[model samples]
Target: MGGPSGASGTAAAPERRSGLNRVSQQRAEAEERQRIAEGRHSDPFAYLGGPHGPSRRVRIYHPEAAAVAFSEGTEVPRVAGTDFFEAPLPEALEAPYQVCWRDAGGAWHTAYDPYAFPPVLSEFDLHLYAEGRHWHAQRFLGAHCTTVDGVAGVVFSVWAPNAERVSVVGDFNRWDGRRHPMRLRLEAGVWELFIPGVEPGALYKFELRGAGGCGPLLKTDPCGRRYQHRPETAAVVEPPEAYPWGDDAWMERRRREGSAWQQAPWSIYEVHLGSWQRDVGGGFLDYRTLAHELVDYVQRTGFTHIELLPITEHPLDDSWGYQATGYFAPTSRFGEPDAFRYFVDYCHRHGIGVILDWVPAHFPRDAWALARFDGTPLYEHADPRQGEHRDWGTLIFNFGRNEVRSFLLSSALYWLEAYHLDGLRVDAVASMLYLNYSREDGDWVPNIHGGNENLEAIAFLREVNTVTHGEQPGTCIIAEESTSWPQVTRPTYLGGLGFTMKWNMGWMHDTLTYLGEDPVHRRYHHDQLTFGLLYAFTENFVLPFSHDEVVHGKGSLLDRMPGDDWQRLANLRLLYAYQFTYPGKKLLFMGCEIGQRSEWDADATVDWAALSDPRHAGVQRLVSDLNALYRGVPALHRYDFAEAGFAWVDCHDAEQSVLSYLRRGDAGEQALVVLNFTPVPRHGHRLGVPAPGRWTERMNTDSAYYGGSDLGNAGGVLAEPVPWSGYPYSVTLTLPPLAGLVLVGEGA
Candidate 1:
C-alpha cells in the first residue's frame, strides 16, 4: 500500500503500525521532531535514519520542508503540521539516498541526510584520549572532510567535557546553534558531528552550553590546523594533504644526528616573521616571498639554522607571537598554513634547519578563546593565583589535569610530525618552573610539598621531553631557562627535564655588560667576562644574544658600545670573535648583523638601509665569516659542552684588560684566541705557547677589510725555547687595540 500524501492520503503501507502501536510511534516521532527543532536532542540519530524496524519503517526530520520523499521508499507521511515525516521501506539503507524536498515558496531541493552515516571516531581513539597520551590529537579531533556512505561532509569534534550541550555553528548553517547539535562521547568528553555539504574554507566555532550562569560560549578550535585571518578569529576548514614536501635528505640527516646537536655548530639566526621583512607597500610579506628572501639571506649569511619567534596564530602583532592562541595553526599574518609549510620545506631543501619558538607557559585572557572555555575554567585553574599570569594578564595551563596535559603534549608532537620542523625553542621556561615567578609576596601558592617549585609543570616538562626525544630521534628541545635548574639537559631517567639544550642566559648578560664598558674602566669589571666560564660546560648551551637585549628601551647591540666610531666598530667586531670562538653553540637576533642602532620594533621591518654604510656592512660580513669559521674549524665547535674543549691562558691580565684562551677539538686540533680591550696597542707582547711551533693568524678583527685600522701580526709567530707564563715556550707579537685575533698552530 502507498503511504499518505499531504492532506489527502490513501491507506497506510501494508501491515503498517495500527491501534495503540500506531498512536505510540506517532507520539515518539512527534517528540523526536520537537527535540530536533529545539536543538536539544540527546540522541537525534537514533530516530532520524532509515530502516528503523522489522517492517523497514523509515523516518526523517527536515524542519524546513513542506513536502518530501525518498527515491526508494514510499512517499512519507507529513505527520500533521510539523516537519516530522515518515514512510515504510522494503530494504535497509546500504548506500546514500537523496531527499527530494519542496519549500514554502514551492522550490525543489535535494541533499544527503547527515544521519545516514556511522560514527567516525573509533573506540581506541576514545581510550587513548581518555588516558591523556594522545600525542597526535589534531589528526582526529578537529574539522576534517571525508566521504561517508558515498556522501561528503566535514567531521567536527572538540573537547568540552563540562558542556550540557554542544553544537557546531558556521556560515553553512546560518551560524545558528539550533540547527545541528553534536553527539557526545561520554568517556572522552568529546562532542562530534558530521555535517553534509560543508566544504573547505568554511569559517566555524563551537557553541557550548553549560550549567553556569554565563551564556553559551563560542570558542575557536584548539586543534584547528588553519585559521581565518585576524580581525576575524574563526577556525577555517583546510585539508592537511594540501602541502607536499621535498626534504627527505634533510630529514635523513637529522635522523642520523639523533639528539646529538651539542657539537653540530648550530649558529641560529633568530627572526620575528612580522618584522623580518616588509613589502614595498609596508605590509607583511607572505610566507612564499619570505621562503625565497629569507632562505637566500640565511644561506649567504652562513647560518646553519633559522629560529622564528613563535609563528603560531596570534592576535596582537605587539605580542610578537608569544601570546599565541592557536597552537596547531600557523599565524595567518603572513600566509596560509600550507604556505608556511612551504617556507620550512624550502629551508630544509636548501640545507637550513627551522626551529619555532613555542610558548606553553601562558595564554592571553581574551574572552573568545581558551579562557572560561565551556562556561568554566576548562583549560585553566579556577583560582587566580594558580591560573593567572599577573604581569601579562594571561591564563596559565592547569597541568594537573589529564586532558590539559594531553593537549599540550599533542601540540608539541604535532609540529614535529606534521610540519617536519627540526626543533622547538620553548619560551619562558623559568616562569613555568617557579611558582613565585614575577609574583610579589603573598600573591602565590606552594606545591604539594610546600615548595615554590611548580611540580605539575615540572612533570609536564619532563614528560614532554621524554616523549619527543624518544619518539622523534633527531629533533631537539631547547629551554629558555634563566635559573640554576640542575640537569636541565639530562635524560628523563636521570630525573632531568630531558631537554637537548638550554640558553646560557648568564653568559649573555655578563658578556654583553663587559663589552659595553669603556676600555679604560674595563679592568675593574674584568670578572664579568671570565665569570661565565665558571659554569660554561654545565649544560649543552646555546650562547644567545636574542631579541631581549635589543628591545623595550635597552637599545641595540651597536648602541650599547661606549666609544667613538672606529673604537665602537672594532669593539663590536671583537665581541663577535669572542662569541664564535668561545665554547658553546651560537644564536643572534635579526638586524643585529647590520649594526642596527635603535631598539627592535615589532611593527616595522629590519633596517635594510643600514647596509649602505660600510661600517654596518662590515659588521654583517664579519658575522658571516664567523659562521663559516665556526662550522669549518672543529676546534671552535667540537666538544663545546665538555671541559676538554677550553682553557684560560691569561685570566689575570686585568692591568692591560687583555684575555687569552685555547679552544680544542676531539681530534687534537688547537686554536689560540686573544682579546685586547684598551685603545693602546701592545707591542712585542710575550704570549706563552703549549707547543714549540709556528702559529698563523687565522682571523684578525682589526683588519682593514672589516672597516678596522689594519693592525695585526706580520703573518705568523714562532715559539722560542724560553719558558714563560706556565708554558714551555713563549712568543712575542703585537696585539691590536680594541680588537680580537685567532691563531691556529701549524699542522692544526
Candidate 2:
C-alpha cells in the first residue's frame, strides 16, 4: 500500500507542473495577441520612435493613427483626424516616428520614441445627480480627481450620467477635442485614462460631447492649491531631486528643543512673495532672491512662522491665485517648481515653520485647460445651476467621488512630503462647506430646509484633515472659515472636520471696527474686544491681518486709525500690543509690521521704506519687543487652550476708556495687560491685578524705541488687596492715553 501511494503522488506532481507551464504559455500568448489588437497604443512604453537617448516613458493617446512629419517650427499637414504631430523634446526629431497613434476620432497624433510627449487633458465639465437615473429631475454635482494612475497624478474623472459622450481637451492636443476622447469605464459611471507620460506641468481638461457639440469649459481642479495657465502655462517640470539640505539637522535640533510645530507659540507673518518685494525692472523676484531677502526679513521680524499665500500657478497676471489652472505645477512666474522647494527648504533651515495658504474651494473658468475637459463636465458639475460659482465666476468641484477625494488628499500629502511644509491654511472654508453659501435661493440646492452645507465637501475636508494630520504628525491644518461652524478645530474622528486652528474672524472684524471708531464710540464697543473670550474654548484661534482686510477700498490698518498721524501711530502701537497679548496665536500682514501706509495691491511692492519714519519706527519697535516679551512670558505661550490662560481683571472703566486683563499660568508666571483708549494721559490711575507687589513695565507702546513719548512709569507699585474684588492685588498706576502697557511682576 505504501509503494502504491508514493507512485501515485510522484505521478500527480508531474502532471500538476505540466499543467502550470501550459497555463503560463497560454497567458503569455493571450497578452501578446491583446497588445497587437490594441495596436501598441495601450502600452505607451513600447515602440519608441525617437533617436537613441535616455529611455524614458511616453504617453501616446492613439497608437493606431499615422504621422505627418514637418520641418522645425513649421506646422504639419492636416490629415483627416490629425490634430498635430510633434515630439516632447526638440532633439527627438533626429529619428522621428518613434511613437504614433490615431486618437478616438481617428485623428493622427504622433510623438518621439522613448521620450514621447506627455498627453494633455483639458476642458472638463461635470454633472452631478441626487440619484443616478434622472436627468432633468436631478441636482447638479461637482467633480474633482480623487486619485491618479493608482499612485496619484491629478486623477481626472467626473460623473455625468446624462451626457452621451465625453472627451478631455487642452494643451495636450492643442485643444483639439476630437483627438483625445475619454473612454467610459466601469459600472460606477467613471471615465478614465492612463496616460503615463503626463507629469506635473502639463495643462489639460475634459471635453463633454452630449446632445450638442460641447458644453462650456470647466476648471477641473477648482480647489487646486497650485495651478498655471495652458499652452502658455508653466512647463510640465520633471524636477531633478537634488538639494544639500541643512534642514534635516535643523528639524532634528528643533525636535530636541521641543520645537515641533505643535510646541511652539505660533506667530505667523503672512506674505505674498510676488508683491512682497518685486524686482524694480517690472518682473517677479526669483525664489532664491526671495529666500535670501524675504526669509531674512521674516526672521528679523521676530515671527515664529511664515504663512505664504498660494504659490500655485494661475492664468491672469494679477489674480491673487484664486483662479487656478495647473493644479500640480507651481507658478513659473516665481521660478521653477524646484526653486519653490528650495525656498521652503530655506525656511526650515532657519528654524522657522512654513504654512501654505491652500484654496480648494472653486476653480477659474479657462477654456484652454481643465474646463469642459473630456468634452464634458468631467471635472466639474454638468448642470450649470450647481457646477458654476456665480460670485467668483469659477467652476465648483464635485467632491463625492472616491477618485476625486483621493486626488485632493494626495495634494495635501504632496506639499507636506515633498516641500516639508509645516502646515496648511485652507482658504474659503466657508464657501467649500456650503452648496448655496453665496448663491441665491433659486440658484442653489439645499441639503435640508434652510441648510446648504455641501455634504460631499464636508466629507472631503474631514478626509483631508484625517489624512494630513494622520500622515504628518505635528503638522497643523488651519481653516479660514468665517461661519460659526461648530468645533472647526476639533479632531475629524470626533464628528468634526479636524483643523488645528481657525482664523478668529469675529475677533478681526470686531477689533478692526472698534479701532476705526472714535475714542468716544470705542467705550461702547469694548465688548467687541472682550466678547471673543465667550467662544475661545471652541477652537484654537489666530488673530490675522491677512490680505483680505487690506485689499480694495478697505485701506491699510494705519489708515483705519481714528486720529491724526501721531494718534494713529499710537493707536496702531496699542493695537499691536493687544494682538500679541491676546489669548491666541497671531498673524500679521507683510507690510503691517513696518506700518505700510497704503492698502495692499497685488501689482505693487510693499513700502519697505516706511520703516525710516519715527512714527512707523515705533510700530516696528513695538513689534520686535512684543516678540521678545511673548517669548519670555511662559504664560503667554503655554497651553493656550486652557481657560486658566486668560482672565478679565477689569472692564468697568468705560468713561476713562481703560481695560485690563491678565494672562497667567499655573506656575506663578503672569503678564498684566493694560490699555488706555483715551487721547490724553491719565496720571495715578487705579488698575486691578490678580497678584500685585511691585509691577515693572516690561513693554510700553509709548516707549522711545517705538517712536512714542516716555510718559510711562518705569516702575509701578501695587499695594492694596481687596477681598471684595476677585483679584488678589491692585495698583495705582499712570496710564498714557492711546497707549497699551504690558507689566510683569517681580520674581514670584
Candidate 3:
C-alpha cells in the first residue's frame, strides 16, 4: 500500500509545480504588454522591437493591425487579449528587420521597428547641452533628418529633465504615444529616438509623463523650425537644406566693412509685414511676393535698412509676434522658412539691410508651449514674482538657468546665421533689465545688492551681444531700451551691455511732447528740443519713431501735430527733417512716411491710398529726399554718434520758436539745419553758420515740391562776415513757416 501511493504522489507534485510556473510567466508577460500599451514603460528599448530574454524574441505593438509578420514572411502571433506581437528572431534577419503589418481593413504596410535603433545624440552633445553651453543646441534637439546604419529617417530629440517617460507622437503613429517611446540620455536629461521613413513635413509633438505623476503633457518641440498656422499647434519637421544664396557680394562687403554702418547713413523703414500691405482679399502676402514688392518700395523710398516687426511664429495675430511660441520658426502665416530666407536675400542683393525685431523678454503661456515645460518650472522661474509678466499675461524666461540662456542665445544666433540677417532690434529691453518692471514693491524680487536691476538678464544680454557680434561680425545688435541704462551700447569687456546701439526713447518722448504743443505755447517748452543735445552722444543711438508711437490711442505721428491740417502736415515735415538732421541714426515706421491719419493697425494695411493726397505724397517725397540727402551729404551722417560732429548754432531762439544746428564732417564739410516752428514766416531771419562761403539749399521742406508755400533761401545764400548766435558768419534768409531747411556749404 505505501509503494503504490509514492509513484502517484510524485507525478502529481511535479505537474502542480509546472502549472504554477506557467501561470506566473503568463501574468508577467501580460503586465509588460499593459505597460507598453499604456505608454508608461520608461525604457521601451529594453522590452520591445529588439531581441530580449534568453529566447531573443522580437516584440511589436500594433493595436490597429489585424496581423503582423517579419519582412521575410515570418508570421508573428499576438499574445491573447493584448496588442503585443512576438516571434523568435530569425537567424537570417538583423535587428532592424522590417515589420510588415495588415491593418484591420487588411491593407498591408511595412516599416523598420523604431526601437531597434540606438540613441542618436552624441555624448559630447549631451554634455554641452547639460552645461547650457551649446550655442547650436537646435541642430540636435529638434527633429532632424539623418541616416542611421545607412537607413534614412528623422531623429527627434528634446530636453525634458522632469519627465519620467516621453513618447514621440505624430500622424505616423496615429497620434498614439505608446507606438514610439524615446530613450532618455541621463546625462543631459534629453529624450531621443530615430524613426525610419519619417521624412520632412511630418507633424509631431512629445507626449510626456511627469516624475511626480503630474502629467501626460503634450508639448510641441521647443526648437521647432516651423509650425502649423494658428489654431493648430503641431510642430513640423523641416530638415536643414542648403539655400542657394546669391548674396556673396553683400555678405563679403558686410564682413569687410565692420563698424562702417555706424557712420553710414541709416534711414531704417520699420514695417509690420502683416499690415504693411495685403492681397486683394486683405490676407497676408507670402514671403516670396513680399520680397519683390517690399524690396522695390524700400529701394524707391531710399531707406537703407528695413526693420521688420517680429516674424517669429505666434498663435495670435494681434500680438504682432511679440507673444512668441516658436523662436526658431518663421511664422507660417507668411509661407515656409526658405521663402523668408529669400526675402532677406533679395533685400541684401538690393543694398538694403534687414533687421528683425527679436523678443526674448517673455513668452505667452500657451499650454502646448514652453510654459511649465516638463511639468515643472523648467524654462521659466518657479516663483510667480520672477517668472510672470502681469502686464503681458506671459511668463518670463528663467535667465538664471544655463539651459534657458542657451535656448535664447541659440535663437538669436539662429536668425542671424540661418537667414543672414543684418541685425536684431531687441524688443522690450527695459522690461528685461529691471526686476521691478511693471510690478509693485512686494510683487518683485530685488538683486543681491538690493538693486532693481535683473542681474541675470543683464549677464544674459551681455553674453548674447558678445556672442552675436563675435560670431556674426558687422551685424548690429540694437536694444529697444527706454530707460537711462548706463552703457547699454558700450563694450562688454569695458563693463557695459555691449549693444551696437540703443533706441533714443528720451529724445522721441521729448520731441513728440514738444511738437504736440500749440505753436504759440511751444516757446515755453523749448527745452524739450534742446535738452536732448546735452546727452545725445552719451551712447550710440537710433532715433526711432517706432510702432509704439502710433498705437494705444496715441494716434499717428501726424495726428500728434497740434495744428490745422495745413499746419499739421508742415509740422510733420519739420519732425522728419529734425530726426534726419539730429545727431543719431534714424528709424521711421511704415505709415508715418505717407502721413497716415489713423493709428497703426496690425489687422489693417497701411493707408497706401492716402498717397493720392498731395500733402501725403509730399511727405513721402520729403522722406525720400531726406534719405538721399542723409546718404549723399557727409556732414549729416559722418558724425551721427560723435560729439565732435554736432554743434548748436542757435538753440536759444525760443522767442522766434526757431532752432538752428550745424552738422560737421571729417574734412570740414559742414551743413546748417534750421527749423522754424511757428506758422508765421520770418522774411529776414539771420541763422549763424560756421563757414562764410555760399550755402546751397539742399532740401527745403517748405518748397512747392513738398506741398509747402515754397518760401526759402533763393537757391544759394552768402554768409556775411558778422558774428551772430556765437558763430563767425551769419546768413540773413527768409525762414519758411513751420518748416525745416538743410543748406550745405559750397567749399572749405
> TM-score, each model?
0.93, 0.76, 0.96
Evaluate residue 470 in candidate 2 and report its C-alpha lDDT on the 0 to 100 scale.
Answer: 66
Positional deviation of residue 259's Cα in model 1 after best superposition, in angstroms: 3.7
lDDT of 2 by residue, 363-464 (tens): 777775555654556567887766888878888776775545644565677777667788889989998888878877688877655678888899888878
What's the distance in Å from true for residue 80, model 1? Answer: 4.6
User: How far out, in Å, is residue 697 in model 2?
Assistant: 1.0
**For each candidate, what is the lDDT?**
0.85, 0.67, 0.92
**What are the runs in model 2 whose C-alpha is more than 4 Å off?**
1-231, 234-244, 250-263, 448-450, 716-724
Sorting all predicted structures by lDDT, with the top scorer first, yields 3, 1, 2
> What tens-digit string does per-residue lDDT give for candidate 3 at 153-172?
99999998889889999998
Better of 2 and 3 by lDDT: 3
Q: What's the ranking of the predictions by TM-score, best on top? A: 3, 1, 2
Top-scoring candidate (TM-score): 3
Can you give the lDDT of residue 153 in candidate 3?
Answer: 97
| Count of clashing residue pairs in every prediction | 0, 75, 0
